[model samples]
Target: MRLHVADHPLVAHKLSVLRDAKTPSPTFRQLVDELVTLLAYEATRDVRTHEVEVVTPVATTTGVKLADPNPIVVPILRAGLGMLEGMTRLVPTAEVGFLGLQRDEETLEAITYANRLPDDLTGRQCFLLDPMLATGNTLVASIDYLLQRGARDVTAVCLIAAPEGLKVVEEFVGDRADVQIVVAAVDERLNEKAYIVPGLGDAGDRLYGIV
Candidate 1:
């Protein structure tokens, strides 16, 4: 598994505002979209592409296009939904899928409530979207699900991540498959409630109001 923590200044600027408690929900949502787009740009760096022939008025030339099996974007529902627009804006032709998993607060286990993805993802590069990475149980389960369907590779995009979550994902995926994480920031740590310290609060609540 590989981890890439975005270090751009614009990412920091937007993330700082997103973390402010006084930022209204409207502003918070907007920042999340902007920040996710920035992170998405970095996340898709390894997406498969193929060279193709193209014709110009002056001459014929070669260009690169998304690979044959085309990547799939799977947003982990609710909070992850908030990131969809930003990601799709950058990859307009990519297929979209949905996976709904909620953590059991008492057990810290992730339970699948819904799945709208292809039953077989063999040789498909999959991108998983989830805003905050705290305990990482949910992300681990999500990746496992994709692997079960024979996904070729999986990359998770997150706004903020706690070290604990990174460790858990790394250990769980040791030499297992091509797994990676692209995050805007790796915050200090998680609090007692398993929330990313200095995170943008509960992403779902901030984006859609407490539910």
Candidate 2:
């Protein structure tokens, strides 16, 4: 698995506000949308495209267009939902799918409750939207799930990640398939309770509030 940490002044600035415990939900949501859009630019750098010939006002020219079996964007439920709009804003024509996987706080395991995706994703390029990558269990499970469905290429877009979690993902993914992780920042560590230390607290809660 390859990891890419977005390097940009704008990305850094917005992320600082997002890390603030004092930031309100309304503003938090807005920043997430904007930040994700920026990150989406990097995440989709190698997105599949094919050449096409088009007629312009001046003359005919060749250009690239998104390839067939349009890339699928699957935002893990709840917190991941917060990132959907931003991702789609960048790839408006990409197909949208949903996967509901909640982390079991007690065991820190990912449990799949719902999913809307193609049965056979043999050649599909999938992008997963999830805000945090703390323990990496959820992402590992999600990636495995996609691979089981025959998706050989998968990219996960996250706002923040922990080194431990990235290590877990890398260990689990070795030589299996093509996978990439794109994140805004990699925080210090994961605390005892499995929360990222010196990191933004509970992205789902910050994004949508507690139920």
Candidate 3:
């Protein structure tokens, strides 16, 4: 799988704030939304489009419009849910889907507790949104499910990732050219519990307040 790490000062600035433990939930949520928007722009660089002719007051002009097969945006709940609005703001035409995946605390294995995606995803370009990529089990499982349903291409967008997770996803995708990962930053490592070290810390908790 290919990887794209956003290389912009503004992105880095916002990420720094997000990383600070002192940032509150309200601020964290806002920053995440902004960060996701920036990453989505980078992640959708190859989103399918087709040439179109438009008639202006002066003359006819040619432009490109998003392709017929609207892209699908799936946000792994519930942390992933925080990124939905930011992603859709950029690709408003994209269809939205949901998947509830969480790691088993004891085993650190991803489990899909809920899924609400189309059965036939043939030719669809899907964007999977999740805030963190630490262990990668959830991402691998999510991609596998989308591929199983016939998704032709998949792009996963995350705010932060660990080296271990990146390696895991790369190995899991193997020679799948259609799969790619877009992240804001690759942190140093994963903690014992499989959390990204020096990460923003439990993105779900930071975004939505403790339950």
Candidate 4:
């Protein structure tokens, strides 16, 4: 698994405001959307495409178009839902899927509460969206489900990640050359309750008010 942390100045500028405790909920949501758009740009770098000949006003030109098997965008529900619009803004034609996963408070393990994805994902490129990569159990489980269904490649986009989460994902996806993780920032560590420290508080709560 390869990890990408956006280094662009604009990304950093928005992220700083997003992390501020004083930022209101409405503004936070907007920032998250904008940040995801920037992150999605890097995440879809390997999206499959095919060359096509198009007739421009002046002459014929060769351009690239997304391949026949449209890319799949799966947002791990609740918090992940916040990222969907931004991702689709980049690849509007991509198919959308949903996977609802929540963490077991006691064990900090991920449990799938809902899944509605295509049965056969062969030749499909999947983009998994989840805001926080705290422990990585949810992301790992989500990726396993996609790979099991024959997804050709998988990329996960997150707003923030913890070192512990990154390690777990890297180890869990060992030897999987086609998997990649794109995150805005990798925080210091995970707190006892399994939240990234110095990280933006619960993403779901911040985006939709404490639930």
- Model 3's lDDT to the true fold? 0.94
In the range 95-197, model 3's lDDT, one tens digit per residue, is 9999999999999889999999999999999999999999999999999999889985999999999999999999999876489899999999998888899
Q: Measured by TM-score, how close is model 4 to the native structure?
A: 0.97
- Candidate 4 lDDT by residue in tens digits, 1-211: 8999999999999989988999999999999999999999999998888999999999999999999889999999999999999999999999999999999999989999999999999888899999999998999899999988987589999998999998998898888638899998888999888888999888899999976
lDDT of 2 at 176: 95
Find the 10 residues in a row with the least total lDDT in model 4. 170-179
Worst 10-residue lDDT window, candidate 1: 192-201
Worst 10 residues of 2 by lDDT: 195-204
Q: What is the lDDT of residue 189 in candidate 3?
A: 99
Winner of 1 and 3 under TM-score: 3
Model 2 misplaced stretches (Cα beyond 4 Å): none
lDDT of 1 by residue, 29-119 (tens): 8888899899999999988899999999999999999997878999998899999989998988889999999989988899999999999
lDDT tens string, model 2, 1-211? 9999999999999999999999999999999999999999999999999999999999999999999889999999989999999999999999998999999999999999999988888899999999999999999999998999999999999999999999999999999999999999999999999998778999999999988
**Model 1 spans with C-alpha error above 4 angstroms:** none
Q: In order, what lDDT does every prediction score?
A: 0.92, 0.95, 0.94, 0.92
What would the TM-scores of all predictions be? Answer: 0.97, 0.98, 0.98, 0.97
